[model samples]
Target: MGKWNAKGLELAQKLEGVTDEKAIKKLATETMQEIIDACPGEGSIKRPRAALRKAIESVYPSLNAEDNYPQGYYRTSEGKGKGERYEHLALWYLTTNIDRWSVEGDEGRQQYWGNLPTLEKTEPKPQQTKQQKPKQKETVMSQLNLDLDTETQQALDFALKQSGLEEKEFISRAIAYYAKSIANRHEVDFATIPTEKLLNDSSLAKLPGRAEELTRRAVRAISIYNDDIAPENSERWAITQSAIARLTGGRAKSIQKALEDYQGMIADHHAKYELNNYSNRKSGGRTIEDTINIAEL
Candidate 1:
């Protein structure tokens, strides 16, 4: 009962109402075979076997009593000698140990058998020194106040109710996600753009707004998709098609189609750009400029 591993617990369960010695021995044999099969390696076999042996010896102490035969006599003998006799002894040990543990008082049981035969060998956890202890993370707290229009407030409420998130959590997450997306987008843009044009590009000013719009569209698409397939619950998007249409200014089907089209475009673009040294030019193909120069020549 005290954190017995699967095999040990199983043997114990099978032993219940099994008063016959033959049945117990058979169960012991089967359990030993299973343990051996589970752990075949020499290094891995010792602890489980020892635990099982201890269990059996505890229940039937007579088995552990000194044999009249000489120590090396059984090893040299052919049939049903020491190795064969104790081949399945581990299981009997486990069964007997389980029985003994069951009868003991609570304190005695805890003291003796509480941590026995988890089946896997467990090493003692090393004590953590003052220097080894993990340093606590310092959190900087900030406050924000937002004034919303009635329509915006209603939309925020609807989103919060549908998403099953607290207003503070949702707002914090939204801000964090938006900030991360903007930062990533800016980094990509900086890397890709020519240095001279980078400062002069008027379109750079609109990147944040474009990113926000794309982010909103993505979030809306995900929300619609979740609602369409999700199980019926308070958390599920339970809004009617007409309500969805009104909110999104398009039918659910149209929104889904648009999302699919957008995803396909993204996939196509990635596939197109992912290849190394990709170009429209064929091997040994002449450029239009080269043909024009030849004609001039």
Candidate 2:
């Protein structure tokens, strides 16, 4: 399309910024008529100069330019070869204000190339590219030293192997499991109720594992308290106590009450486990669980 001569260059210059296909076609038709008029003889079929043809081709990328697509002759072949023949003039038609055009045959074809020339401005738009942050490298791998007793160490190892995970991953998962089970997220007290209540309640019955879920949450809270409230644990600091009191609406007695409630839950579980069993099959021990006084225990 770049073989433009002096005349073609002049035509291109005349059609500059004229992106509308209709406008370009009108200009092209006017140019062709002028060329025909300039020919020495009236009936002479003059081949257009390379410059003129290049100018048109540059403007229109399609096979034939004029009116719209399929405006020129259709070359119908009987058998082999390159399929069809075109006897009409083919030229480029600009569809966008940008460097884009459609090939047209005459004023007859309806199909277009690239984007259809709209009345609205069709300039290619710039995009907003996001800037990404560079990732930071890990500096230190913080470690925890658990001085586990023989039984606990054995259990940890057994659990690590059983869960098919690395020691650190196993510990992390274990902590997450217990931590996530807490009822402290909402005010619902799972520790105070039995599974039967949730199971029997018509409203809760349809909720699968509602009782177990609540029970797990309650158990998690107890476990957290048992582990963290010890003097050695980081959570047992004076600041933590003050924070807890402040979180409980600055009620001085609330923390005490909560502690007593949590203690009661642990005692209840221990008492139940010790006394309520039908039998300890491994130990060959029998239980008179009903007769055991919880207060005495």
Candidate 3:
């Protein structure tokens, strides 16, 4: 692109605040026509210069007048290395409008050959090393409990379907396994009624687990105790006490008693057990230190 010349600069400076594109184009066209008219001959460099000036003026109104060469033209491959094609004309047309650039910065300004960088290429960063997770020990029950990823779960479902167990039986066993898993969450050993007991024992057939039996008892105890002691007190707290009673055999109820009474005792018993479990767990085996020492002796 050829740099904007004296005539183009002067025209651009003339129309600084004229924002309308059509108006600017019109002004540019008229100014170029005037410059051409002023020039002596039709095919003179003066005519092309005037046209170039007009285009620059139209596009870049706020061009720096102090600079000697604010814009320039270069040759294009089209038109057999032409003098100045329509594309060059369009460049002049677009570049002339300084308003096309940002208001605060020189982002729209074209980089010139003088400012081209000669810096070396930067090397890429090394890839990060990912640490492998430690391998977990697998037991039969552990494998059974291993979170069969969703894919494995589907496979297990299919495998279970192929097994001779009925769908209902499968569900029962699954539920029992699930309950056992929950019961094992804190400690490896805690006195707990077996799933077989729940299924076979008439008294416990309806009970899900010790905790559940406790919960039922707690709820029932709270309901009853609230009536006997204070109707407005905490039912949930009473229920918790009932759980403790059931586990310790300290509550004044038999399993043969009303459902509410039995449920209360179970609740009281479980609550106390849970509290002790929590304390023992937090002490990091210190809670049982004396017992361990005695056993060792």
The alpha-carbon lDDT assigned to residue 289 of candidate 3 equals 21
> Candidate 3 residues 39-69, lDDT tens each?
3333453446655645563554332333343
Q: Kindly report which residue stretches of model 3 are placed more than 4 angstroms away from their true locations once superposed.
A: 1-4, 45-297
| Whole-model lDDT per candidate | 0.39, 0.38, 0.37
Query: Judged by lDDT, which candidate is best?
Result: 1
- TM-score ranking, high to low: 2, 1, 3
Instruction: Arrange candidates, best lDDT first.
Output: 1, 2, 3
lDDT of 2 by residue, 1-297 (tens): 332255666776766666555566655544543443344322331344444766655654333223243432333222365344332232432111111122344333434332343222233323321111111101111245566689987776555445544344556667775665453243454445554453245444323344334333334433444344434332221112122222222222333334443556555644543421122111222111222211122
Runs of candidate 2 with Cα error greater than 4 angstroms are 1-4, 42-45, 49-51, 58-107, 110-297
- Residue lDDT tens for model 1, 135-241: 31012112343566789867865665465443455567778867855764663434354423432354453443332233234334434433454343222221222
Least lDDT summed over 10 consecutive residues: which range in candidate 3? 128-137
lDDT assessment of candidate 2: 0.38
Of the pair 1 and 3, which is ahead by TM-score?
1
What does the lDDT read for residue 65 in candidate 3?
30
